[model samples]
Structure formats: C-alpha cells, structure tokens
Target: MSDNLQEDQQQAVLCDMCTEEDRKPARKTCMKCEISMCVHHLQAHVTTPVLLQTHPLTEPMASGAAGTTKCPQHGKLLEYYCLDDLTCVCVSCAIEDQHRLHNMKTFSTAHKELMEKLNAEQQALAKDENVSLEKWENGEREKLGSSSVRLIEAVSKLRDIALTSVQTSVSARMVSIKTSKSSMQVAQNEKDTFRFLQMFSQVHQDFEKAKAVDLRKGLEPGSDRDKLVQELRQGGEEMVAQAVQLWGSLLILVDPENHQEVFTTSSDLTFDPQSLGIGMSLSKDHRKVFYNSWLGQLSAHTLRIRSVHSTSNFQRWMVSLSEDCDWTIGLCDKESAENLKDGHVYGLRCQGNQLSSLTTDYYDFTDASRNLEDSSFGLQKVEIPKTEKKRRVSSQLIKCPGESGGDITPRPQKVEVFRNIAASSLSFFSRTGQHQRTEILTMKMSFDSSDFFAFVNLEKEQAQKSSNQPPGPQQQWMCSCGKVYIETGSGYSYGGCYYSKSPQAICSCGRVIGGRVIGDPCITEVVCELL
Candidate 1:
C-alpha cells in the first residue's frame, strides 16, 4: 500500500505556472549552471546569459531534477554553495554590507522557501475570489437599473411630440375656416346692395326723360309731375349712397394682396439639472447613468449617396463637442458593396464652429455592425418625460411644488412663440409679408462626469431679442471632438469671445473685427434673419 501511494504521488507532480504532465528529467536540468530545478524555471535558467558566466560547467542534481539555479537579485548562477545561513546571494551581493554580516547559504534553501510562500498566497487568493465576484455582480445590477430610467423617458417624449403636433394642426385648420367664412359673408352683402342701387338708378333716369318730353310738349300741368319726379329722385339718391357705403365695406371681406399676418415666436427651453459628468446619475430615481468612452478614429467625410431620401427614415442626431472640429453623423446601417461601388459616402467638414456633415442614412442607436463605424460605448437609452397640457387663454400661472402663493402671476413680458413652418403640407404664408412662418428643433442633452450629472434643453431661438434686454449666456458650446469653448476676459485672446457680442470683448488675434458679426458666429448661438 505504501509503494502504491508513493507512485500515485509521483504521477501527480505539477507545474506552478500551468497544468501539465510531470516534467521529464533531461528537460528539467539547466544547462548553464547545473542544479536541482523545477519545471517552472528550468528553461529560463539555461537561457539567462548572466547565469552561464558564473556556472558554465556545473553538474545537475540527481534523483529529483537536474537544472541550474539563478540568483534572484541579479539572475547570476549559484556556483559556490554556502552552508552557514541558508540564503542565496550573488557574487556582488555576497560582498555587500548586509550579506557580509551573515554567513551566506546555497540557492536550494532560499528557493524552497520562496516556493512555499507562493503556494500559501495562491490558496489565500482563491478564497478571496468569491467575495470579489459578489461585489462585481452587485455593481452590474445597479448599472442596469440606472439605464432603464433614461430609456423610458426618451420613448415617452417622442410620443408626446407626435400628439402635440396633431393637436396644433387641427387648431390651425379651424382658424383658417373661420376666417374664410367671415370674408365670404362681407363680399356677398356688398354685391347685393350694389345690384339694388343700379336697378333703382335706371328707373329714375327713364322717369326724368319722360318729364323732359312732357315739358317740351306742354301737354299737361307740371306741378304734379314735378312732385312725383322729385320724390322718385330722392329715393334713387338714397339707394345710391347706401350702395357706395356697402361697396367700401367689401374691402374687409376681400383676400387682399396683403392680409393680416400671424407671427409666432418659439419659447426658450430650460433644463432642470445643470451638468452631468461621466458615470454620473441623471436623476434621483437611480434609473439613469452617464457613460463616456473613447471610440476609434473615424474618417467622417467619406459617405456619398447617389439618391436623397426623406428624413423620417434617418436616425436621431448626436452632437458631441471636443476641442477638435469633428462633427460626426452616424447612420443606422453601413454601406453595402453596391453602395460603396456607387460612391454613396457623404463628406462632412467643419465650417468655423459649426459642423456641416450629412449622412446617407441616420442612426439613433450606436451599433457598429448596423452602423458604418463603432458606436460610442457610454451612450445610454432612457426615457423620463413630462407631458404639456393645453390651457385656456385666461389660464392661471404655472407654479411648482412648495410655492408660498396659491398661484404665481404671469409676467407681462413678451413671449416669443415659435411655430413649425416646415409643416407646409397644410399651411402656406407669403414670404414678403410682415409675418413669416418659422420652425424649431429642440435637443435634449445631458452633461456628466464620474460624480456630476445635469440635464439641459437646447434649442435655436429666433434672432430677434425676445426680452427688452439681451439674452442670458448660453448653457454650453462644444466642438466636434467633444471639446468645450471657454470664454476669457482677454478681449481677442479668449477662445469663444472672438465671436461673442461684448463691447468690452475684442479679438486679441487682431485677425478679425470684434463682436458677433465680425466672424461667422457659431450656430450654437441664436441667429435671426428676415425671410
């Protein structure tokens, strides 16, 4: 039984680095400095040049394994064995102060100790793995929970926009119909009055001709005829005056070359949370998270499409700002062989602070397989939206929770409301008229870092100042590479101030004039123009 157990143990000898069959005797020995060696380090000892210099002709150990041993410090061979203190020391270290204080030892003793310590560490590490696994699993669950919130909000907002659009269309149509009816009524009344006056006037003229003929003939007494004729003339004159008044009023019913113009200004969008940084929470519900990671470099100017299509099939637009002007527009699908062969790539270049890039097909999600390039890793999908309800013209002012007053008073300030002029399928306005149609798109953006997160609404406002005073500072401005524009007090030297409208702020570069009009100001800022 003892013999059988010894054979089983011998068969089970293993390498520290990996799981392999028991090492062969010849392969185990180090050629540079012969000594007892394990399979883990036998090859390394032989290949080391430093070990060969010290023990070029040493013999291998018998019974266990034949190999050379190397000094741990300098990788030198262990040629001269010491018997006093059991520790390995290189030739240089052997004469050092620390080693000189003790009686040095051979390589075998130190090597054995090192192997034993390594085995203990291995066992301890295995025990700790279970704890680490639990922690990792918990973290993953939290991430999933956060992303769910953002996705829900995004989806809900889309639905609300659709419903609002339908309601606005119906309201506009009703207004148009009412105006048309009013115009028709005024025109019809004027025509009726004019016809009546013309008929009466013709009768009076014939009567006058008859009176003249009778007077000339002197056939009858004139007083009765004159009285009758006078009364008839007076009635004709009254009818003619009425007709003139009615005809003048007809202008009100006419759809003249210039009509009453309706002007709508867009409302300013404000964000609830201010700034969200990387890996930050977007909301208190713990259902939203922000992630930002670097994707590979992409050549954004290559997309060329032979045919243009409607924007409905395109994906949502993503705006990233960095110091570099690399505005990227990703598509949901990659160009196939047919597309590539046909040169379906679109070229996008940076013009000042704006990016004028186009995409053959737009993409909402960042999917590399479906998209032409790898998608950003940190983008998350979430939905959390509040719906707006229509109220009467005499509606009470809106107030949030914890307000001291029952209801706040609406400010007498002029509000610029923007209308969707792009929806011309139903309405058209003359360009030269006083009132022109307008449309606006609002982008929901969240800025974040590891610990900070904020959500802000961004939209293009009409060029004219809505308030008596100039507008407040914009929330943020970014370049294509996700770089932010920083404003400085130094007149022209500052980055963003080069194009801002500050009398005190001038371009330090002296290359251009000062103010917003000096250079082409970024579209990120509100720009206004008359149609």
Candidate 2:
C-alpha cells in the first residue's frame, strides 16, 4: 500500500539486450535462456525464427535463486520432473532418448500438487491419532474415578469402626476409675491410711484390664485387604469354564450394556410374528421370543418356523440364550416341520452344550437283544449306551455348549447358535459371564433345506419358578463313573454331581449338581460362572 512499486522498479533487472544509457526493466525470464528481457526484447525473441515455437518463462524470485537448481540426470538446471521414472529432468534432457517417453511435468506444478495431497493425508492422520488418544485417556479417567470412590468408602468405614472401639474402651475405663474413686473416698472418710495405700495395686490392675481390650481386632478387617488383593490377582488365576473355546486363541470384546439390552436391538435379530409357535409372543422390539399367557398354548415339542427362509433371503442368523433358559434352538428347513410324524425330519438340535439330531446315518430300532430307548414324539434318540447304572434321563432336556456331538450333556447357561443356512452349516457357541464367545460346535452342513432355512423351536411356556425349592424327598447323588456316591432309597433324582473320585470331572456342562447327596445345598443351584 505504501508504494512498494517504487522499490520493485528500483530493483528491476535490466534487459540483457538493452544498452546501459536507456536500460529497461525486465518483464519475463526465459528458464531455457537463463536470462531476463524487457517487453520490446521479449517480443523480438518470441518473433525470431531462431527461437523455438515457444519459450518457457517464469517470474524472478527475491533471492535470485530461481532456475539455479541443477538436475543430476543431464547436469542442466532442473526445469521438469519425470513422474514415471521418479527422476529430475532438465529442459534439454526431457527430449533425450532416456526421458523422451517419460511423463514429465514442470517442477513447480508437480510440487504444488503433491504438497496438497501430503497435507490432506497428514491432516487425516492427525485427526485419527487424536481420537484414539482421547478414548484411552477417557478410559483411564473412568477407572480412576471408580477406584477413588471405592477407596474413599472403604477408608471411611474403617475409620468409624476404629473410633467406636477406642470410645468404648475409654468409657469402660472411666467407669472403673469412678468406682475406685468412691472406695478411696470411703476409706478416707473413715480415716484409714492403710486401706487407701493397699488400693493402689487394685487401681493398677483395673488400668491393665482397660489396656487389654484389643485396638486392632475388628477395626482392622483383614478380609477387606484380602478382597483387594484377590481382585488384583483374579485375571491371573487358572479358570475352568464351559464354552466353545477356539482352536488356539481369540480376542473377545464385550459391552455388558449391549448384551443386557439385546432385546431392544431390532437390526440384529429377525423374527417373523406369523411363524411363531402357539403361545409364543415377541418382545423387546421383536428380538425375543417369549411365552404369552393370553394365547392358547401348544405342545412344547411344536416347531416354530420363520416366515423367510435364511437360505434364500438371509445368509445367516443367530439366536442367543441365557443360562437356565429353555429352548431347543436349531436349524431347520420347510421339510423339517412337515411329515415329522413319519419318524424323521432334517434339522440340527442343540440341547445344552451337546449337539444331537438324527443324521443321514440313524439307529436300527429293530434290535430286540440290545437295550432300546423310548422315542419321544417327533424326536428319535439313539439308545444311550448302558452305564453301570441305567439312570433315567429327565423329561425336561437341558443342553450345554462345547459338548461332543452325541453327548446328552446339558448346557445350562448363556450361548448363541449361528446358522448359515445356505452353506448347510450350523455353529454352536457359548458366552461366559465375561461375555466372551467360545465356539461350541461346527458340524458339516447336513441340514440342507429343501425349502426352509431359518427356523427356531421354543417351549410353549417357561417352567414356573419355585422359590427355595428343596431337594425332592428321594434325591440321590450319582457319579459320572456310574456309581452312586450318596444313595437315597427315596428314588428322586437330580443332575449328577460335578466331581468324581477321579482327577478330572468329565461331562458336557462342565459340572454336575447333586443337592442332598453331597451334603451341599449349593449343588441345588445351577451355577453359571464365578463372578
């Protein structure tokens, strides 16, 4: 604004062709010519036949360093860069045999374009890094906040207990001292020096008794400290659990809120209301299949079909279950539900951790010599191999995860079954309390749907919950080794106990429960995982 024009004019370069007496400021600089020219000389240079059709021109820099950088390839000032070869090329070298076919661009133009690209990528990287750092910091902050709250509560509780202990001790001591004082006063009032002198030892004994009360007993609870230690060490302890463990290792991420609120997520679960079995109702935005008291009920064995076949419309679907939840949970097609009274249908049934279903190969039911199991309606069981004791299986079926294909083991906890209907496969997996997915079973695609691919089976009604239900009058604890550990003549039966005389307990559900037999009431409770 203050006339830098005069300064520019004063520093203007003289035309190389102009005379000193009538010098003219340069208007253009030819990069090939490596010189400047005034307007008149520039026009003459452009018109001259000796010059090429066009000459490259650029503005002068304040430092006068423009057009001074040399190219390593041809040893001339670098005017262009060959992007194809990733090399610098001078004006003279650009037409040479080595770079004639190369894709060359002016250095300034190429540099400008590349700089913009680099800046954009750098900005994106910075944004990503900031987001990750913020998340990590937030997690640390939450942990610190929770820990501070717990510590403050624990300390305050201990402080109150210590204060109360000392206060009680002091009060008791004061009462003893008062009694001694009264006795001393009596002695003095009677004017007896001998009795008062002897009273000192008695008073000393009373003081010792006051000191005997423990200052650290209940006030310093060792259990509280032990709890903190145990929490810190919990991750390192060896844990025994039942689930579909991976072949080697896996990383599981969980959001407890996400799991608890699964019923509300409509996008993940697909339910067809029309295909529901009688007495079953949809809940939690149609993500859950639950019993409906208002609806007329059907037999528990009735199969619930999905309106849409997974093989055609949906490629995959998964059903999640909780521990102690009752559901057959499987993959079946249109034919699976039809003609089942004919003693067969194609489907995969997961009961507890075990995967059991009639396959292409089935039992020969005609064997009279061998013991045979009674077939249930719409279900055929290969006669269970006879153990030493032929214990009767419960009418209610419990399935477990991670059990062998033929095992009758019960899975009594949270698990999910994934069906890839088209691929003709079903996967059984389980989730621990920690919400980690362990794969339970992956069978070869056998339930190829002739029609239906997406199907589910559920009980008509949930068994009513009985509070504090004691062991039946005839409960007995049976071992996996087929011997009764605690025999009861009452003839009532519970799930077998978990532990045996052997080193390891082998069963599908991981543990067995026998209430009165092992003298453990805890056995009556279906345990999921140790929290």
Candidate 3:
C-alpha cells in the first residue's frame, strides 16, 4: 500500500538558485540559461542584474499544462492582446488596467488581422511594382533608352581611342627597340616563341627600355569609378522618391520616430463617476451606461468621454447604439453637463445635415436614413417616440398589530427634477442599430496631450410620456417644494431646439441622487457615462 501511494504521488525539480542557497525545490527552469529556480528566486532572476543577465523568467513546468509562459506582473497566463494598448495582458490586467477600456482581441484573432493587413500591403506593393515599373518604363524608357544608346556609343568610342593609342605606341616602341637592340646577338630571334607571345615580350621589353630613356611623356588623369558613382546618384534619386511614396500608401509602419505621419493607439476613454446622474451605472470599462429602473428622476447632466490631447495621440473609435438608443455622443467642456435648463435639452445643437461648428465640436451628429422624418433627429419634422408603460414601486407604511389596526395605503408620489448645465460648446450624435453595434459612429480627434477633454451624454425627455422631442429636447420640471424650477425653453440653445412655452411636468420626490457614474466616466479634471 505504501509503495503504491508513493507511485501515485507527483514529483518536481528544485530551483537551481534556491538549491545554491539551500536544498529548496525549483519552480521552473530558464530555457535561456538551463537553470531552475523557486518562485522567490524566479522573481529575483528577473530583477537581480547578475541573475537577470544570465537567466530569463518563465512559468514553472510543474504548474500545469498551460505551458511555461506567464505574465511578469501577475505570473498568470497572457492569453489576450489589447488592440488599443498593443500589448499582451493577463485576465486580471485586462479587467483592471486601462486595457479594460481598450479594444481587446484574442491572440489568434489579432495575429490573423495583422497577417491580413500585411498580406494586403504585400498585394499593394506587388501592384505598385507592376504599375509603377510599367509606367516609369513607358514614360522614361524611350528617353532613357536613347541615353543608354548614347552611353554605349560613348563607351565604345573611349575603348576605341584607348586601343588606338596603345597600338600606335606599341608600333613606335617596336621601331625604337629594333634600333636600340640591333647590336644584340639574337641570330634566331624570329624563332623565339609563338607569334603573339613574342610580340608581347618584345613590346614589354621595349617599353621598359623606353621608360629608362623617358620616351612617353604625357597621359590624361581621370577616374572611371568616380564617373559611375556620379551617374548612379543622379539617376537613382527619382526612383527612390517614387518608392517612398508607394510605401507610405501601402505600408503602416508603427514607430514613435515616425509620429509626424504615423497613427498610434489613443489612450482609453473612461468617464468620471462624479459627472454621472442618479440611477445610472457604468460597466465594462465605462463603455456602457445603464439606468437601473424605468422610473425617471430628473437630472440635467450629459455623459462625457475622457479626452486625449497629446500630439502623439491619434485615434478613431466607434460607439454601438441600440435601436432604442436616444442618447447622443458629443464633445464638450466641463460645465456643459452641469448647467441644465428646465425644459430645454442640453446636449448637442444640431441644425441641418451640417453640425453647428466643426471647429468648436469635433463633429456634428447625423443619422443614416433615406428620409429625415422617419429618423428621430430630423431637424424640422421631429417625431415623438412611441409610448411604453413602466412599473413603479411605491412605498407604503406597514401597520403593526394593534386594537385599532388599519390597512396601510400609499400617497401620490411627487415628481423628481433634474437640471443640466450650459457647456462652453457641446456636440453629440444620436444612437442607432441592433445591440447598438451596427450603427457605429467613428470619431477622429487629434490634439496636444496638454489640453482637457470632457465627453457628455443626455437622453432627452427619457421618462416623458411622449417621444415627440427634437434631437436634444428637454422636459420642464418643477420641484415638489416649488422652490427650484428651471426655465422651460432656455436650455443651452446653440444647436438644440430654440423655442418658447412648452408643457412642463411635475418633479418626482426631491432626492439628492449622487452626481456621477459608478465607474470612471470621462471628467476633464478627468471623462464615459452615457445615459
């Protein structure tokens, strides 16, 4: 039984570093160094200069079948890649870090996407090579071909000139040699060797003798190598320039050094909870804002996304909107969501198809529809949303058992009032599509990192019985105490509707619901809770 139990137990190798200090077990082996270390020594191996230089950190072989790869931070498996951050992260890191707000994809998916784009670039380069080469040949070939002909002619002429000079000098030298060596005893000189070899020997011997007598006096000075280099530089410049242009169009090279033209990942956008209204909660890295119940409590606050200002920051992001989304996405300053008018909408100020100010707002909001009337944000013919009933729970007093016990009854509930503040300049877009995924609006913002950005959202008359409000319509509300009542038609009337005297609703029980979303909603101080 003891032998069987021993056989059933698992075994492991001890860490080499730990064993050096004591008889400790090794957690994992460093593939680079072929040494094992305990968990403690594993960490030191990465931090200690001597150990780090000789060893690298890896997962313990005994841990599981997950392989010997672990995140440096949590010692967890790095299974996901953050597309927005461009990094590999553990499950914990993905849920807590800015990566939580970022776009994440599986490693396999990311690899596929990258390979696809790279393949696209390869295809583009192939096309460029064919088209550009053909066009360049057609345009410059006839002309350059003539130059080539001229070049060949010039080379041939130079070679001919050289051969002529060599021949004339050799003939002259031979004559001089005969005259100088006439006294030598070479009776059988005609039978010295083959005709060609004899001629070469005679010419060399004559040249040597002439040098001693200072026969040849002058030769031109030049460099064939230098001339070739100069010609190559002049002709290659144009071809190099065309290659650079084609590379820019087809290849997306990511590097900080190329920031002037490269598009890098933008920082994650999150909302400050302090900027959110009552009853709304932020979830999934502040990407979604949810109202707990259908019971509407009036609050004049717009949702905002955090702003990125650094020149290195350039990002384009899309927001998914449900078919029932009445919310708007926009850019604005801090005070925009704080200052609310009673009945006037506070978010965007949309006019026609064109937005109010491209300079002021990053963009103007518009819908993808054939007719303006069928859409909720038609500038002129604004149609109200259809009605839906919601259940409201009322608080009733409980009667304790007594001689004069009476049945408990509930009283009429007072309406709640919420107000929105006037922003310096607010911009927004209406939501559309199923799961809010289909009708995604992409916004591109490029700016210096030093500036502040505040994104805000406002759902117009959300709790109101009718959906007949304009793009950013607000409902009027008077407090139950009648102490605080905002002006009906005096909201920040920049791009929203500008009107007078509209119907007003009673405020619900005046309760000070905390301002802000549950998670980070973008606050310039901060910003992304959208209601």
Candidate 4:
C-alpha cells in the first residue's frame, strides 16, 4: 500500500521498452527513437557511438508517444527543421512542401544552434540596455542642471535691478526730507525777536515744503518707481512664459519621430512694405516682390517680412524665383537684418550659375563668384536654363512658349526654407516636383532669444511673376461712410465683396449697395461709388 502511494505521488514515467507488469521509471527520453528508457536501458544510447551522435536526448517527457513525434501534415517522423520558416518538418515536408528550398538541418542541430543564438542575443541586449540607461540618466541630469542655472541667473539679475532702483529712489527722497527738517529746526530755536521775525518767512516756507514732501510720491502711479516696478513684473512674467514654452518645445523635439511634423508646417508670410528696399514692388497681397532695377550701385536690397517669429519657433516658407534671376533668400535675426554685411545670418545665395550658402558675416558677391567650388560654404554650380512650361497666373494657366514662339520663357525655381530652432538648423531645399524636394544645404548655428525674420535680396533680374496680380486696372469703390475699398484684382474688393462670384457690398453705414451675380455690368456700377 505504501509503495503504491509513493509511486502515485511521484507520478513517474515508465520505460516504454519495459513490460507492463515490471515497468520502470524513465531517466531520459530519446526524441529520435520516440521512446523513454530507464538508466539501465539508456546505456545503449550512451555507449553506442552511432546512437550517441544521431539521437537527441532530453529530460523525461511524460508522453514519449510516436504520435507526438510525427508530423501532423505528412504523418512521418519530424526529422528536420526549416531555418527559414523556423518550424520542424518531416522528410516528405522537406522534399515536397514550401520548405523545399529552405535551409534545413537535423532537429538536434537546429535546437542546439537556436539555443546558442538566443543566449548570445540576450547577452548583447543586456549590455546595450545598460549603456542606454546610463546615457539617458546622465543627459537628463545635465539638462536639468543647465536649465536651473539659467533660470536662477535670470531671476537674480531681475531682483538686483529692482532692488537697486528702489534703493536709489528711497535714498534720494530721504536725503531731501532730512535736509528740510534740519533747516526748520534751526529757525524754530531762534531766541531774538528781530532775528526770529526775519527767519519767520524762511522757516514757514521750509515748514510748508517739508509738509508737502511725500516720500510715497516716488511710488505714485506716474512716477519712475511705479513704472519700473510694473516693467519688472511684466518682464518676470514674460520670462516665465518663455521658459515654459522653450522647455515644452524641447520635450517635443526629443522624439525624433516628431521632427517632420514639427518643421513641415508652412507659414503664410507677406513682405513688409516698410522694409522694402528701393526698386522693389510688391503684389496686392504683399507676397511677391519684383526687382525691376536697382536705384544705385548697391543693387542688392534685402526685404524683410512683417511678422516676427521667436527664435525657438519652427518656420518654413518657399520662394519661387525666375531661372535667370540672382537672388538671396533666408532667415535673419532682427539685429542681423539691420547689418547683414557684419552680422550672422543663414541663407542660400544664387548668383549666375552657382548656388551657395549665405552666411552673412562673410557675404560677398565677388567671393561667391570666385569660390563656386568651395566645399566650406556648400556651394554647388547649377544650370538654370530656360524651359517652356505652363505657369499659373491669376487663377489662369498661361502657357509659356519657346523662344522661337515670341513668348516669355518660364523658368521658375522654387526653394523651400526650413528653420528648426530646437536643433539650431536652417535647411534649404530645392523643389524638384510636386511632392519631391532635394536638400540644397543646411546651416548649423546656435540661436539666442531674439526675433527672426525672413529676408530676400535680389541682385540683378526679376524673379517669377506674382500669382496674385490683377488682370487689369483694379476698380475702386467707396462706402457711404467714406471708406474707400480698393479692388484686389481677384474679383474682390477690400470691402468684402466677391465681384467675380456672388457680388454684394454691405457698407459700414448699414446700407446694402449691390447684390447680383458676376458679369453684370450694373453690379459694378451699383457697388462702385468711385473716388
């Protein structure tokens, strides 16, 4: 009874070669033979060289049945493994199935090789994980320390300014008050009647002055102290907001996958007329500028955009130029734009047949012409040949003919500029097709907390024609309240009337001027109270 209980508790696997009445527990299982054997019965596999080499032995399996070892599909013993498919296969499978051309190995060899490969991979991965973790930890600490130091320095500077201003104002007021008090006391101590009378007027005047002297007046609403305080408060708030924005941008920039989305959003920009140099004319939308001719020997004029962008923001824009035009387009900080010849700026300059990087500090037309092959500036000589193509103008596709056809040859070159402030990279790309672009050059530099603006300098000829040009002389209209609305040349007026579509003009005087469909001559007459 006790032996039977012990056997049941052990749940031992009996030797498949033993008789049923005298079955013995198995020590190992031979997968090749599909049988279990006790230690005594396993000696043949251990001593026999052929069986030792061929048979694959494993710890005793509960079911060493032939059915488990046979292939499910072919009903043959699974003898080979397919390395390509990573599966066990039978002889029939190896010869007939999809595993025919795959690299095959015996089951024992495949198992041994797979185990070794897995162990090696595990070790390599462990080492890589440790190294990456250390790097991340160190980088995180460094970033935090640097940011903290900058913030502390800014705060300390602000505090010092505020304290100095307050102390200076308070000290000046206290000195004035003390001087007045001493003068009044000396007059009050006069003993002689005659002297007292003579000093009476001066004493009374000094007393009145002292009484009117209000120390708090320095901190009054319109005083310098008050203004300084307000400025400091506002400045501190702005600094905090900027720090938060910069940190947020940095976090987003850390993920490499977000880079494309971060830098691809295009900015809708217009040229600032105030910044336009002589000889440049802008389109109705202030987007396109034409260089008819230079007014002086300094033919090159830099035009800036009206909108100012933070150095930490991402900005992208495209400039389309005529093939024969010599132009420079790029980004410049506010200070650099003022003095491009002596300041730091990043851009692409195209002169004659060469396209080179535009580093403003070393910018010179002669240098660019002489050093076209200079790799330091990433200069590339490109051919800008005249090509006949259809160009879109004012919502119309104008077909430009060849030189023989007596029509203008269209050769537009579109260059895209990308500014990534987080990475401090300004990249220029040439648009090759509708959906393809080739990188022209990339300028790497550190950016400070300054405003950046897009600028363009035309050296010689005019670039592409403006797409928003009016087909004819723009019609003008006037409201009853004397608001003159100029025609936009796109069948619309500045007064919010779509003359080409559903024509209507609602005056500021609450009067509806005209409501009619396009092509009606009366519609124009009705809306246009011409100035």
Candidate lDDT scores, in order, read: 0.35, 0.49, 0.43, 0.62
What TM-score number comes out for model 1?
0.21
Residue-level lDDT tens digits of model 2 in 1-531: 456975585357667667989878777767667777888888866788666444566664222544465565556766688888877778777886588888888867888877998999999989878997799678756755555555555555555654666576557556766666665556557555687677767766665655555545532346754664464344223111211121011222233322321122225345666665544544434555443233444344433434332324224344554333334554444544433323223334443334454333233334334555565665554554432422111122324545556455445245455455456666655545344455555655443344543445543223552445333222233333333333344332335533443325333445442333433322221111111
Tens-digit lDDT track for model 4 on 233-335?
Answer: 8879866865764464455447432222223333446778887665344555566554322232225667786554444467677776644346677777776
Clashing pairs in 4: none
Residue 324 lDDT in candidate 1: 23
The runs of at least 3 residues in candidate 3 whose Cα sits more than 4 Å from the true structure, single-residue gaps closed, are 1-267, 294-298, 307-313, 322-326, 340-454, 462-531
Worst 10-residue lDDT window for candidate 2 reads: 240-249
Measure candidate 2: CA RMSD. 20.1
Better of 1 and 3 by lDDT: 3
Clashes of each: 52, 19, 61, 0
Candidate 4's TM-score: 0.40
Candidate 3: 10-residue stretch with minimal lDDT: 410-419
Q: Candidate 2: deviation at residue 167, Å?
A: 6.7
How do all models score by TM-score? 0.21, 0.33, 0.22, 0.40
The most accurate candidate by lDDT is 4
Per-residue lDDT for 421 in model 4? 74
Which residue ranges in model 4 land beyond 4 Å of their true spot? Answer: 1-25, 44-56, 64-70, 130-132, 174-256, 259-531
Residue-by-residue lDDT tens digits, candidate 1, 218-295: 213357546645654665565554444333333322543333333321112211222332212222322221221221
